[model samples]
Target: MKSILITTTALVGFAATAGAQEVNVVSWGGAYEKSQVEAYNKPFTEETGITVNMIAADNPATPLKAQVEANNVTGDVFDIEVSDAIRMCDEGALVEIDPADLPAAPDGTAAADDFIDGALQDCAVANIFWGTVIAYDTTKFEGQAPSTAADFFDLETYPGKRGLPKNPKRTLYLALIADGASPDEIYDLLGSDEGVQRAFDKLDTIKSDVVWWEAGAQPPQLLADGEVTMATGYNGRFFDAMVGEGKPFEIIWDGQYMDMDMFVIPKDAPNPEAAMEYLKFATDTQRLADQAKYIAYGPARQSSASLVGMYQDGKTEMAPHMPTNPDHLETAVMDDPEFWADHDAELSERFNAWLASS
Candidate 1:
């Protein structure tokens, strides 16, 4: 009887161990992925003993949709853009994540109040506020650096091929900014046909001089390879090249396009419980704060701000490099998820047409 009782306890332990398992998370690759691995994934594993299998995607939303539609979901969680998260939530493609389930700030402040406005969603939780900005090879310019959006269009002044993304969502705003539209009025202007034409017209000036890039890693490489004098890309990627690799690159704060990245669980995730646990563990104030050490993107929680210090190098300050810095925000265009959610399809179609035309 004693031996039977011991055997029963060992079997129960094995079953519990099997239940406590891993989650597959799909996210954007490169420096952003490295930051998450160091800040969220590693620490979450250390604390909970649940392994996080990191999968890289150019954009997590693409595969997430594919998985949901096929009804064969592999990824347990996905780090996606605000527009995608909201769109998927509305379409019942993502699981609802209540804010009440989130961990609170260290000071005991409620999670709802600690996070920045729009950082929380019915089915998602924002991890960072990042930006797409103009980055230039410092060696290419002598005096009077490109300071504003108009400078990106002035090929004669800067005098080299410009690296622009092929997508409409990131390109249209800068076109309007260069055309003299204020950041506050970008979405309002882009809403009208005439306004879109105006943006494309502005882009037309640089079209001949443009060297289009699709990946986040390509812009820095474009500048490094002398393929482009200036390129627009994620600020954190630029930061990584500049600080980590000692690349001579500089970011132009003028007209930065800011957006949020959130974590969402699919409607039928492979490991729904583990995905939720990882989401809660990863987005807490400390974990969010820790991410800043690896990248320049700002943490979503207000409480995380006070705790953010130097980079992993242990000396370089992280604040001024952040997209959320006051200096960077002066002419920044904050992304409107609802606007993109509504116009993405139509504008994307039009953008493709415009791109292939001339």
Candidate 2:
């Protein structure tokens, strides 16, 4: 029995030693980036003795593409938005993953199963889900706040300065939704001349009320500084400001457009095996739950839902923005990256033309 125990311990030590390897990663960097590195990546290195080489980028793919084009692909694992992931995969910039080798899905959760449909695909898997919702200063609204995308366009009823993303996809979808088109109808509508024109025409009606936000971080600051009474914003930022800072802002989840960020292994990554292990570890339920504490985006693992309480009580006032909350999830319309990847250029051309005209 003593010899068997000694053998088991020896094997475990050998496995641990073998797992230690150096890997390079390219990812979006900011306060959120630092949080992830500290919370997950650092611990991972300590456990396995793997050396992590992290490259920070405001936009990771541009650098990733440059590396791949140079045939010196250094990044083992990288992060990109869903639309970008699809584009990169189509361009042969990412590696195909075998899901079976991934870490066990959180108990009671099928691996990636809790992710919204189509969120996990051939070349990428959703790392986080976020939303753009109608955020308003509760004190200013007094009696009622805008409850839907249509209300966002109802300048008279919800009368306040507004903010919207400068990007075409989000603006167009919001316009279509406000125009009373269902999520299914949005693609076909945008695909047609009449539909595209209709959306622009709607935007033309409220152009003057809008402060077009150029960056993802801009909308929240606009709200905090009282630049706009009601604006569309990423739920994570808004929730952080409202909950952490005790702001009077409130977010309406109804009609929110759900967007996702994903993880993709860059082609010809130097340490592919280590990258795969890290990917599985990052997507595991506990790690995802820890990430959610600092970043408000919803975890991709379904089992992480129950772990949400680690941050705050599930019923807290900010609960509406929690991605796993049924009420919020039910009202969300998942953005289709394929449609965006294909049509974005044309849509942007028309949208810019219309904005210039307005």
Candidate 3:
């Protein structure tokens, strides 16, 4: 009888601790993080009493990879790009997620069927669809504003410092677009040495005037500080700076690279159960749609589209600002996760070497 009482007491204590557990989530910072905090994290904490701790990353994939490799996983959940999610899953770094465990849509459709095609994988569940596009300071361009991808590389025409990310995945595509490679031909051309050489050559044209940025927040800061007249950055970040902060910025949607952001749990997450619980709660139709209130990125779920309306400011319509808006899709570049999953290593090495030279 004494042993049974002690065992019951221990079980009750464990339940109390579990109810108060915290899950660490790593995601891209700036407006994106703020959106998640408002839309997902706070509500989740209120409902479950599980505290959600956010950690920002330039790209969450970088730190996720490091943590998995070192066998020291600290974060419970990570928001990463589709390509990175695939790569990490293949490497056995992520925990497999079953679609059946996810919440069903309001119409009673199963999660696997309700989610958009390619939104769900064995190891990740997509939350949002975002893009990288060129944004320029409106105050700097008095006469004519830059509109197309070609204009981004036309140094003499819109002469001033240009801001670009310090990574190949984002930079190379823009270079190819400016070099006249159609969206359909970008991957094919990038498949060859000469094609890559062409991209590098194009980038070299404005190398001296480039201001490289690593984090999403840096581009808007660069433009605001007058360090660069224009920059290539996440469209959502630019939207936040323009609408939320009232920065004089205009996004050029031509040749924007669209990608999905997904949530993945590392293999040895500190709080695996809470991570899974948070992942499902955060990616639901309502939560995904609510995110649009704080940022311009589109929700990955089809049902979530109708729910997305105005921004937090209440008056500004968010449809025109979204990366997936019909008007912005004309020359959009869909991210090829399979290609990047296959060739990222080789291309990254070559890109790093090129960055070192001249």
lDDT of 1: 0.91
Instruction: Name the runs in model 3 displaced over 4 angstroms.
Output: 1-17
Question: Residues 61-117, candidate 1, lDDT per residue (tens digit)?
Answer: 999999999999999999999999999999999999888778778777778999999
The models' CA-based lDDT, in order, is 0.91, 0.75, 0.89
lDDT per residue (tens digit) for residues 37-102 in model 2: 865788677666677787877567778878888999888888778888888888988988765544
Better of 2 and 3 by TM-score: 3
lDDT of 3 by residue, 1-358 (tens): 3433443354345446677799999998778999999999997776667889999988899899898888899999999999999988998899999998887777767789989899999999999999999999999887988999899998888989999998888889889999889998989988999989999999999999999999889999999999999999999989888998899999999999999999999998999988887898898888899999999999988888999999999999999988889999988889999999998999999988988988
lDDT of 1 at 282: 87
Clashing residue pairs in candidate 2, if any? Answer: none
Candidate 1: Cα lDDT at 6: 41
